[model samples]
Target chain A: MTLKGILLSASMIALAGAASAETRIGMITTLSGGGASLGIDVRDGFLLALEQAGRDDIEIIVEDDEQAPDVAVQLADRMIQAEDVDIMTGIIWSNLAMAVVPSVTAQGVFYLSPNAGPSQLAGRGCNQNYFNVAWQNDNLHEAAGAYANSAGYTNSFILAPNYPAGQDALAGYKRFYEGGLAGELYTQLGQTDYAAEIAQIRASGADSVFFFLPGGMGISFLRQYADSGLDIPVIGPAFSFDQNILQAVGADALGVVNTSQWSPDLDNAANTAFVAAFREAYGRIPSLYASQGFDTANLILSALAVADPSDEPDAFREALRAADFASTRGDFAFGPNHHPIQDIYVREVVQEGDIFTNRIIGTALEDRGDAYAAECQM
Target chain B: MSAILIVEQVLNGLQFGVMLFLMAAGLTLIFGVMGLINLAHGSLYMVGAFVAATVAGLTGSFLLALAAAMAAAAMAGAVIEMTVIRRLYHTDHLDQVLATFALILIFSEGTRAIFGSFPLYLDAPALLSGPVTLPLGIEYPRYRLALIAAGLLVALGLWLLIAKTRIGIQIRAGKNDREMIAALGVDIRTLYTFVFALGAALAGLAGALVGAIQSVQVGMGEPVLILAFVVIVIGGIGSIKGAFVGALIVGLTDTLGGIFLPEFFKLFMEPASATQIGASLSSMAIYLLMAAVLIWRPTGLYGVRA
Candidate 1:
């Protein structure tokens, strides 16, 4: 072997030998670029959970993915090969999760996803080593569809960016909404202008509109929609009306209905504590993404307490599947696909004094698992 | 679609077109006069938006925020031209591209550092917040209509400044033969600085105007920058008239193609697959247009003959 290879092996042996029971956790999340806010919240929430648990045996290494799939793959490789991490988590985007999760799981490392539960991973690609703390990608959209039906909407206009998640969003909505679609338009991903789409919506004579444009695209759409003078009631996944986004959207998003598995105002003992602690720590309201990260960390800690990852791999997997920890989303449980089966609630955007945040109005889908779970052989 | 819907979509196309023209005009001017391919032009646009958002937040005045945006971007452009871009003028295109690309990273990080990751809030002025009825009984956003008018006004002003003023003569002479202008005792360096700053101001104006309707966030300018480059390329490099025409073409093709292509395909194909194919094709429509333009008249529709 070359001297470099020999030295690396020596260090690996030393690291392995030195920490008999220490677990290394690798976190790959978007901490820069357009999606940085989500990552920051996730990281902060994860760190907050660990700090509260006081788990010094768990060594967590965080790296910025820069919202790119390729960067996430590289970080996963480096963490697995060099750091010899026993657990991996903290991928926020579905595309990046798809890029990294399968390979990491195949390599015998446990991956606990804090966010991004793409349907592929929840179905045919399901692995024993993978667990998702967040709801499946289509869960909120499905809830939106259910809520729309209950609200007695007969005609709805739906739109989303043309991508995998966008397709999932529309399909999820269509699965439950029995109403006839007034229009369905798939604009280019990252498209900021929605004037043409809005014009079509104005002309379509729809009773309601549903969209799934996340991040800045959502902000742009909401602003333009407000300016368009079209008064059709609008609904979407909570991604568009999240705390961080609502601040950017200003007053335009007020009174909009959105569906989510968790909200800052979700009334529960765990959620109340999480919101308080998160505000104390970050000086901002926690988003659903943050709650997901917190729950992911708590689940890991719960599993670690029950069985060791390196020594009792099967037991650790079973422990994760059991999901014994108290979730910010109360009554969380894993479905057959290891994705969360939880109540998805409908929320309304409201201004509490100065800050814009969501208030839970009603449960759209209670104990809702994913449609793809039956496809998973596992 | 009804005729009224078509009219509204066309108006939307014109609004988007004018915004693209604002960005492309500045980019074309800098390239035309200085022959500098500045990728950092987008960063300047971002700076303008962020500055506008901050000013509007603090002062609660949209017009003042717009003025601040222009001043900040122009000052930034002048400084960058003097300090960093000035040296690269004598270098090759590769070096210029590399340096300006690095500027994009620096500016993006710097803006993020100051503004944080969350997008800042900016909205249209109260006077232009809602829609207005047009002659054809079509309702459109007053803010977008104002954008089209402002863009056309700027285009007219730019045309007048270039065609009538003495400084315009110097700029034209510099584009043709810089050494000749320098020999004629023109302060060519100052002229270059002024031109860069002027280009920067236009981009800033576009950013502030568009920022009212769009999210004012980091890395917001890069996408528009790509479209602006496509516009300058299709309009012909170093041609102002080409940039304007090219921007309108791109904007209309994109907006109309997005709305119409799927409907056209649904006549013969299943609606689901038709939409999938149509959406995919419309995203590529601009690139295909650029390719067609290049093939027909290499150097662009209005590119000066080599």
Candidate 2:
């Protein structure tokens, strides 16, 4: 075709496409480097949910953030200016979320968090355009704290990486723990060696150890802790005991209690189907991150079915607030801060045949909202 | 802290220093002889750990894994030296840095492509898995003790090889006057390749030993690589002795600072603020030490004054 004819046809096609009201979603997530697995799982789970829903009017654009907050911010800008997405989601880290969410939401774009749920977003900084399908940052740690109280531990030693999420972890544990702290230490983030920390734990005379080291830091700490021959019981959030990390940790992670809002074996139709479908699709057990991603996608789809996101903003926001979706975590609902107010269960890591996974032992917290909800104006 | 705890912490510092020396030793040696700055040294370390983990998974033998780690890393180093690095030897530091930085990306993505993003499992030998009580009634992991011994042994071997062997003579000669030695009929290229491979093997050994204790994941070497750079800087670049002393000082400062800084601050400040300040300061302790060393001795502790 001639140049002018081609240009005319392209503009016509663009106009035709715009008439259908397709919801454009921009996903900026960690896809390479150290934290790639989490982002990959989240993307896979999100894609799986979208596939299951079979939504034809939704368009998604994915970009790698490289686990860097600056890169995430840049991608958010590009997505907003260049792609003009109506919604944003799929940031795996709290710091990255903190960097991108406020600006995106302030610009009148809806952001549905898949994994990261920073306290700032759930507190006074909460935005009407922002929704977190996952529990607040402190939810699982608070559940672990409650479980620690019931386990009858009078004294406990706690540790976490020296970062915002780590501070939140320690504070969350302290909120409901009701135990005397024998020690409270913050190690360097991404620190591989825990000898100094382990020595302190051994010398602290604490009854048990509660730590919030996540990802490879958790694996290293557990292996080194085991080798140090400290027999003290350990408790943590599910990021450490998740299916992906558990295999790397091997038998050492077995029988360790962890808390989370969802599990592969939660004994619900939604969860059972999610697990089966996820395994068939990805050929591995889905992690809590994957579940959150799945839930986030389904939440979007549910809202999309009732109203166009870019056209009727108020109605779409209400539809999202209603959360009319079958969550893998049964009976999921949003709190005042637009974060989940849901039951957090305690799970013990166990081996089934060859694969290592978590099994729900008991409920730790029932229908728990976040501590920061009171601070949220929205 | 109790006497036993202090002793244990000291041992931990020594072990950590020894491990850093393995990484620094090769780095210093390579810089000394080749005058090439290789940022991809860390990639070699990661390659070592990955190879070790793969070998261990297949054989279930820790010894075999270590051997394989050294072999694989040395091979990688030689290949890198010949293909990409050989051309950069005559270039400026910026060009070398850019080229090697590109290599880091390539190796990281390549490893990720081969082994998925998940961390690999590599455990210490069963015999060395538990803690052992020292003479001072301090219980420490036997594997760490082994690590210290192995590091010292390697240090000794390096010292002997450099001080007593013909290749060591050529290496020393090359560092001083490469053109002179080359004109004297020593194949400078072969010597450079050999020195690089040897350094790579040491780094590999360190990676394998440390990987058993830590998670064997992609980009695991970068943090240690930064510390290794600090070590070589403090030890004086291109000086193995300097690297050794610098490594020990860094390790001790880091370990002891982490444990005692908070306590020191708690004596005056409130507990919470003290903990925060102490943690922050402790993380900066090594860098402070490096600064102090640099201020006192611009040439580094053992660095030869140019």
lDDT of 1 by residue, A1-378 (tens): 322333354346435543543888888987876577788788888888888886657777788888888999998998898888899999988888999999999999999999888889999999999999998889999999999999999999999876667878998999999999999988767677789899999989999999998777787888899898888999999887777788877677889999999999888999999999999877899998899899999999999999989889999999999999989988999999999989999999999989889999999999999999999986
Q: What interface RMSD do all candidates show, one decimal each?
A: 1.7, 1.7
B266, model 2: CA deviation in Å? 1.8
| Model 2 docking category | medium
Off by over 4 Å in 2: A1-21
Q: What is the C-alpha RMSD of each candidate to the true structure, in Å?
A: 4.7, 4.5
lDDT of 2 at B39: 94
True contacts kept of each: 0.67, 0.69
The segments of candidate 1 whose C-alpha lies over 4 angstroms from its true place after superposition are A1-21
lDDT of 2: 0.88
- Chain A of candidate 2 gets a TM-score of 0.93
Please give, for residues A174-263, the per-residue lDDT of candidate 2 as tens digits: 999998999999887777889999988988889989998776778788889989988999999998777777877778888999999999
The lowest-lDDT stretch of 10 consecutive residues in candidate 1 chain B is B115-124
- Assess candidate 1 and give its TM-score to the true structure: 0.94
